[model samples]
Target chain A: MSIGSTIICLLGALFMTSSAFGQAMDAPTDLAGTGYFRDQDTLPGSFRFYQQLPGGESGFWGMGPSRPNLRRSSFKIDAHDDVVYYSPEVRCQKCHEPQTKDLHYLRMGITCVQCHRGQPVAGVYQYYSPLNPIRRHAYVCAKCHEGATPSFASYMVHEPNPIASEAQGRFPLLYYAVWFMLILAGGVFVIFLPYTVFWWIRDLVAKLTRRPSHGS
Target chain B: MAVDRTRLKRFPPVQRLWHLGLLVVFMILSVTGIAWMYFETPWGRGLAEQFGGFTGTLEIHRIAGLVMLAGFVLHLLYMLFKIDWKRFSQSLMGPDSLVFQWIDIKGFFAHLGWVFGLRKYPHFDRWSWWEKFDYWAVWWGLIIVGVTGLMLYNPVLTSDFMPGWLLNVALWVHRIEAVLAMGHIFTIHFTVEHWRPSAFPYNASMFDGSVDLEEARHEHPAWVERLEREGRLEGTLVPPPPVPLRILYFVFGYAIILLGLFLLVFAIANAALLTLF
Candidate 1:
């Protein structure tokens, strides 16, 4: 992309997408790098990003129902009972229904030409390998889900503090302090717990069983 | 009904006020801190929504944490100035002082023996070994939480002096210490401090700043005996609190304890459900 195009993209993103924490979202102008996205699987066990955008109905016996529409555009699973996950089906024109047909990156459906640019293809259908395999898929999906052509949500909104999820190599002070705290708490709980529980029960039993002999 | 209607001082106004402050701040910190730490959970998400959102909850946690640390500093200052320099040495090693003595070590075993019915009710002074332990636990907890909290609060500044990884260390330490505090305070403190039958329902002494004379004698026979020997028992006595003041103490104590118990139970149940399923 040219410098002029980059500037145009950034400027366009500023107006198009804003975050809850107030920052201009980066428009994902380069779609191929985002990652491979297959909209729907053909069969039951064949699912990746989503299982299948099941037909609009109450669904089969044990499976969850498909969504009525994408107006809400939410992503969730029943967690406890859902047998299979599904997504709303996406036909080309269902997404590309805008008047400005050329650059409807915000509300448009994806096509082969969008990311493949000039790459050769042998068949009508072939799974494209993710250009940036290292990036999290959640982030790649967030480009469209959270933003129009861009994703403006701060990293804080997207993920936890980077240092927190991964281990910080070796810190003795941390281990020592954690151990000290654990030992202190553990010692109190382990050593005195029997006596503590015993006394509590004793007090409770004494209260329940014994009558107050003194006059009121 | 004829009530003895005699009272003795247990905590002063400053200490009582500090206790109230700690209660409020600790409650806020625990709720806000856990919401973020356990954000992935349903309860965590539910609480985060109550405080507006995750960021809002985080801000509240930070502010309340700073307030707690400030209260801690003020308390230390109060302790220093509250004491008389003329008797500084005595205060350090004094029987009345919160400082641990050889007797506390012995008292620990004696308490165990008494609990098991192997010994007579162990002798106790103004502060029992467990009481001192409770007091000092909070003291050390603040230091750990405060230091690590500050480091996490400003990772950039902390990372300048120390490695970046210390923040992770700080995170776990802060979390473990805090959870332990919640567990200890909710279970053990509630059990021993106010739930004891003699002090059952609610201990008005903490709020009204005086234990009934019977209370003092029951829990602190050695202290009461010392007062009697020094001819100070009569001077230390006061009339019972008014019925309305007693009612207020009951309300206040129950509110805090009930909230604490609810939180403890909720956390345990939530963890159990998450783990089992």
Candidate 2:
């Protein structure tokens, strides 16, 4: 894409990632979504509300890649403890299904609609908000706390060696080995690839001018 | 110049057939493998659709992997049994083998010197160091990828004996190796074999099973000299490949090379855009 399109897309992405402040759901008719916290009676905001679910009742402080704190980056199938893992082993929390879905029961301190809105596309922000809540987890809160699909933020962290799923706390050796391979591959490519490409260009120029090429 | 004389049969008929089979199978594997890796992306998903779908593409990749393994095994057996046990040892050190030699080590540095204009071109042999390196790289990729793919194929079977964490390692190795292979083959391998001025557009030797006498004299001078001294040079010369086969080679070679170029450009463009958008 042109520089203008890239800049426009970047600005649009930045705008879309803007977090919607957690709103209260006092009405009985309102929905208590996945991002909804069962009011710890701490400060009334979303972070205050969501913190209760992990450090409070579920007792699992970091049940995320799904709902880990902003610092939460990666996880694996065999991970556990403070790290994330399978639903039954570590976190069996209601990822999408709320604890109590009583239409009459209203336990929404931070409604998902507040922050998880707008489904933009191709540099168009608010392209599908409300009617089709962009529901993007780019802001650490997709519509339903999606754990299956990783976001661009996750990929940015997995850079240089970009594996589909990384082995972190589960296999500490492999985790570090992955980093080692990344640096090694980077170093090898950086040194060898450009040098050869330079040779190719030089040889091509010589051939065009009817000169004998080097290394023929 | 020996261009006026007959061409040298660099590759035998069977070897040429083997190479053609590998080219087709490898091209398929590379495409299907890329689709599997990037299935999350729209372009990847779209590519997968060409093969059927995600599952279909992966199935093709698996089948191609098995084919590659079979070819590798067949080639190894041929290498081991093609000659008597006594000659096998000698052949390992001989030009007949693809084994790396001390000369290759010197050839590499000498070639680099010529590239920098510090020396004349290095002596060309039956196989260049880079050619041997490329051959071995494929073997390395196959071993790692094939083993890991099998382990992951039946995770339950694997996890029963192997630790689940080992499977994680297998997955990591399988993926990293695939990416490394694709990146290297599409760029460096292509550049060396087909993008050089001497071989610009394409090289027909792999396709037609022989090199022109003049070309062989220039590229594999040491081997040609050895043949001439041993009085085996005339025996190695043969008429050019049949026209139909040459035509097929041109069509097939250009198509694959063009596809490789397109894929390389496509990947770079998307990767950059993905980081931004």
Candidate 3:
């Protein structure tokens, strides 16, 4: 209500907007499937790699395996489970062109289920390959949960080193930004509204009554 | 000093509605808000469980917070339109009210002495330093609480820039701040308005939008003096009948404090019983 209060409110609003924008622009690098090793020197040794070919699943490739780009080896799937054997082999071509595929997965890394058809189910191991112990194993918790097909945590080349294929979930910041703006705006109003209303009525009455004022 | 009855205008309908709405919602919100922060604490857990658990309490807290936030925005816009910049600056940017001044600082110490009759009672104005402190503290608290609250609202979005630890820190700060704020509001703010000897009952100016002349002079002499100087101090008008509205305020305020305390006690008792059983 008061000019000072209004200005403060505006400033708060601006701060919130800027904070939100800053957070949105600065995205976190997802680190799923990169084989997070405790030691930086052991990063290469910690990772195993694989890619599905036309007919069968590939063996676990070492850290510097032929396909250095494919960071994850989802080969642990047991042959007995029909769901595990029947998963589709997704390639870059399905979501984006070949050109963007490298950029999307490698340059701008993404999470496991981003391209995968099924939601990840917890506590069910479908694929296992000892060639690259960590990367070759696949667990689909969704197999037991609702609406789950065979699922695997995919690996991205550009993902941060030493990643947990399982620990992929992240907290959301933009939602906070939006909410922060609204709350800040609200706070500003709460701070000023009372005095403004009281003053307005008081001033209006003073003028209407032709009250002689103390010149001070 | 006397209340310039002629000068005191009736609060607008919108203002009244806003105050009433915020009062009701804030009270509910505060309860649920505290319950949220303490959901893990023994008392908080009990409150949450009584209300049907954390999920249910969280839902109500969010809904109430949103409503309060809406009220907050409307009040801001109203003030933006209501007050002139130059005049408003007197209250906002001018020197701190007397209660915040060096003299009042001295008064605080002296009043402590005066409690033993060594000095006179401190002369106060429309607002005291403690009141001002509370006002500003509430705003700051709201900002911290609101921001942290949002950050925690959606972990997926917040984890973009802020680390899990930082969110954890925010959570810690928000929770601690809520408890501290609850204590301060309950004891300090409530006591100032309702626990003093002369004004022991309460002050209902926040609700009815008016304070009687005697109260005006005793509580806000400077304002009374200003109205007198301006010749708008109701020099010729007969004063209105005394309304013991402060009594209502005292009853309501005391009731809330008692209820909150009782809730706290009951929670502790239940927790003890469960532990024993």
- Candidate achieving the largest lDDT: 1
lDDT of 3 at A165: 25
Q: Give the DockQ (2 decimals) of all models.
A: 0.10, 0.10, 0.03
TM-score of 1: 0.64
Models 1 onward score TM values of: 0.64, 0.64, 0.50
Tens-place lDDT digits, model 1, residues A57-126: 2123212222223221112122112323322243334533431222123213355334322233111112
Please give, for residues B43-157, the per-residue lDDT of candidate 3 as tens digits.
Answer: 7667777677877887877777677666666777976776557677565544333225665576456434433435443455455445566556756766776677777665445
lDDT of 2: 0.60
- Candidate 2 docks at the CAPRI level of incorrect
TM-score of chain B of each: 0.93, 0.92, 0.73
In what order do the candidates fall by lDDT, top score first? Answer: 1, 2, 3
Tens digit per residue, CA lDDT, model 3, A1-216: 999999999999999999888873322243233344233212332333223321012322222112324322232233223344334465434533432423234322443444332433211112322223233223222232233211222222222211222212121222243335445545544643443334334434434555321112
As for lDDT, the candidate ahead, 1 or 3, is 1
Residue B263 lDDT in model 3? 49
**Regions of candidate 2 where Cα sits further than 4 Å from its true position:** A1-170, A205-216, B1-5, B272-277
